[model samples]
Target: MSQFALLGQRRFAPFFWTQALAAFNDNAFRCALLVLVAFQLGLDDHAAAIYTNLAPALFILPFFLFSASAGQLAEKIEKTRIIRWVKWFEIAAMVIAAVGFVMHHVSLLLVVLFMMGLHSTVFGPIKYAILPQALKSAELVGGNGLVEMGTQLAILLGMIVGTTTMGAAEIGPWLAACITIGVAVVGYLACRAIPAAPATAPELKFNPNTFGETARVIRITHADRAVWNAVLGISWFWFFGTVLIAQLPIYTRETLGGDNTVYTLVLTLFTIGSGIGALACEKLSGKRVEIGLVPLGAFGLTAFGVDLYFARHGVAPVRGLGWLGFLRGAGSWRIALDLMLIGAFAGLYVVPLFAFVQARAPREKLSRIIAGNNIMNAVLIVAAAGFGLGMGALGFSAAEIFFAAALLNILVAGYIFTLVPEFILHFFTWTLANTLYRVRADGLRHIPEEGPALLVCNHVSFVDPLLLMANLRRPARFVMYYRIFNIPLLKFLFKTAKAIPIAGQKEDPAVLQQAWDAVDAALADGELVCIFPEGALTRDGAIAPFRPGVEKILARRPVPVVPMALRGLWGSMWSRRDSALGRARLPRRFRARVELVVDAPVSPEHARAAALEARVRELRGDMA
Candidate 1:
């Protein structure tokens, strides 16, 4: 089903709107406050800047102070109930904001700003933790993409609506306040329909001390190295984006030489571009939590960020230019493109990381982990602010900062990639599968979400392992013939993947025994393992008799055995058909349609070599 289809489901649709409206209201209130400070409060430039900047800091402060407690609340209470409470809190906050708007009470409004921040801080963990319960594993990427897109669009429109309504001459402040309050009310109604999300850890202890809880929760997240790095990756995106957003006003005036309208236009490009990129993730990732795109996103972020600096540096002067005038000016389109692409890449960089956190973090502690991520994000955001200030203090222009920030991304990404080679390996496998074959996986859901399983497939080509690796959601260790395992270019890959290399018992008993030991150990530790029952690539485009190797392994360590068949690969480049010297050769099918049909897993007792071979044959059905 299309990712947009989620908009119609009661379980998801209501929650999506509730979340989207929350974002809309948050931005609306924030923009309204900034507008009041800027044009109506009678403050000097220095004073206006202080309020403008301080507002965001106040909004973000709750994330650091209250996130840990909020996460505990989410884990201890039903998510829908908390969402309702949060929505009600938003309504109360907006009501106070209305009074502030009328009296121009900066202090009252600042208090309301902090309250709104508190509302978000409390809702943060509930919002993310509920998705895994609500959506299937396959729906996660699509679901997250939709949420991310909605948030970006909401932010863009909220800023426009709030600022515009507040600044209007005849119906100022009052109308904006009404809209914000109305949105909050509607958001509360939306929360009422969010299907009850059960508390993941109802028995867990609660810590009222935010500081202690914060450190403990952060430790929980950091305990998993992969997840912690993913959190850092997310934090880095915020830092990168925070810097760009902070510089937009200055970039408009000094770099683009444009007025307020041009500034709005540029921000709109970025927001819309991010939405598009987010919506595209489901299709690009094939509905999986594909982290390969993370690297691709990092590449785009650095590439376009640097390009934006150059685009700004060579910008043609367009004094006092409005939106239309800026668009018509030289180098303007390039600048717009750079901003949009950068935002697009930011979406790419973040969606999967969010999904990975949801899927990987322990269910009981997922909310606390999300809270920890929020803390990290807030820290990075503050660091970004400091970086911006330091750059400005050092006399660096906005464009120069952009250039330097882009360069810094390379080092950060390199470090993250070094910490997580799975991301790069996934990219290679994902790209190779998509490029070389139009691959379809049938019955992928048969693979257990978490457990040991022995996969027995009809081996057709040298790249069958790669195909299976790419298609399977869980990683599986493959046992391969030593020659294919030791192929010069593939040796590093085989070793890195921890593929077991084996020789016949008569030739090398030591290698054979080690391979058996490794397979048993992997299964003991609850890992998936795959072996071709045929034992070697088919010399002809026909099925080979099943070997007893699978039977031997099953006898030693019994596990559920899944029978898989690879069809339509007989004519592919990796296949031995019509080849000289039995080497892989290219075929007309550059992107040949290949199907890996996985049958339902049978218990170990029922998965004898003869039975599995018969099952695979039936599935393959004379595809050759």
Candidate 2:
């Protein structure tokens, strides 16, 4: 099903709207307040600057102070109940904001702003932690994509609505107040329809000491290296985003020489682009939590970011140009394209990392991990603010700052990828599979979502592992023939993937023995291991007899065995079909239609080698 179909489901739609409405109100209220301070109140430039600067700090402060406690609360209490309470809290804040808006009470409005921040702080952990419970494993990516797209669009609309309404002279603040309050009430109503999501760790102790619990929660988040890095990747996205967004107003005014309409236009472009990219993740990832897109996103951020600088580094000669006039100017389209693609890539970068954290973190500790992620995000946002301020102080142009951030992205991405080669490996695999074949995977749900499993597949070509790796939702260690494992160009991929290189007893006894030990160990540790039962690639379009290697491994470690078959790969690039016919292999079937058919896993005791070979043959059928 398309991700959009999720909008019709009770499990997802209500939560989606509740969160989207909250996002709308948050941005709406903030934008309205800024308009009041900057234009309506008649504040001097210095005073306006103080309120503008203090606003973000006050809003972000709750994340640092209460995220840990909020995470615990999410874990300790039923989530839907807390969500109801949070919505009511929002209504109260909006009520206060209503009076503040009419009375021109800046202090009261700021207090409401802080209260909204606190609302978000309390909701942060539940936002992510609840997904794993509400969604099927296959639905996680699509669900996250929907949430992301909704949030981006909601934020954009909120900003436009808030700014436009508040820009009116006399009735503006009243209008803003009514709208915010109405949205808050609607959000509360939407959240009421959210089905119950029981606490993951109801028995867990609730630590009231903020400092001690904060450190402890962070420690839990960092317990897994991969999970922690994913969190860091998320934080870096915030840092990059904060810098880019913080500069856009100045960039629009000074660099683009445009008025507020142009600013709105640019904001719309970025937001719409991000929403498109967010919605695209479900299709691009094949509904899996594919992190390969993260690198692709990083590359786009840098490439277009640098190109953006060269597109228009100098200030435009014309001043006070409206959006239309700006768009008609020289090199304007390029700048617009740069901004849009940057937002698009930002969407691709973040959605998967969020899904990855949700899928990877322990269920009991997931809320705390999300809380810790919030804390890190808050710190980075503050740092981004400082970086933007420091660059402005050093007299760097907005375009120059964009250039610097793009360049810095290369370093940050390289560092992160270096620390986790799996990201690069997945990128390579995902690229190869998507480029070489249009893969249709079926019966994949039969593979256990968690725990140990032995996958036995009919090996057809050299790229079989890559295809399977790309399609499998869960990571699996592949066992390949020793010679294929050592192929010069492919050696790094195999080694990084931790593929076990196995040899026949006659060829290399040590290698064969070592492979057996590794297979058993991997299964014992609750990992998935896939092996070719044929032991070598088929020379013709036929299955070889099943070897006893699989049976031997099962005897040692009796994990569930899944039989998988790859079809339409016999004549593909790396297969032996052409070589057997004494002809040069060519790209005859580039982007060939391929199928990966998996059968229900057989219990270890009944998973005989011959039966599995028979099952795989039936699955492959006459397709080859």
Residue 141 alpha-carbon offset, candidate 1, angstroms: 0.5
How well does candidate 1 match the true structure in TM-score terms? 0.97
Off by over 4 Å in 1: 314-316, 486-489, 581-583
lDDT for each residue of candidate 1 in 458-544, tens digit (9 for 90 to 100): 989888998888778777899999877889987878876779898898878999999999999999989999998898888787889
Candidate 1 — what's its lDDT?
Answer: 0.90
**Residue pairs with backbone overlap in model 2:** none
The local distance difference test score of each candidate is 0.90, 0.93
What's the CA RMSD for each of the models?
1.7, 1.2
> Model 2 over residues 1-624: C-alpha lDDT tens digits?
888898999999999999999999999999999999999998999999999999999999999999999999999999999999999999999999999999999999999999999999999999999999999989999999989999999999999999998988799999999999999999999999999999899999999999889999899998998888889999999999999999999999999999999999999998988887888888999999899898998998899999989998887787899999999998999999999999999989899899999999989889999999999999999999999999999999999999999999999989988888888998899999999999999998999999999999999998999999999999999998899789998898899899999998999999999999999999999999999999888998899999988889989998999999999998877888889568747777669899999999999999999999999999999998
Give stretches of model 2 more than 4 Å off: 581-584
In model 2, how large is the Cα lDDT of residue 591?
91
- The TM-score values for the models, in the order shown, are 0.97, 0.98
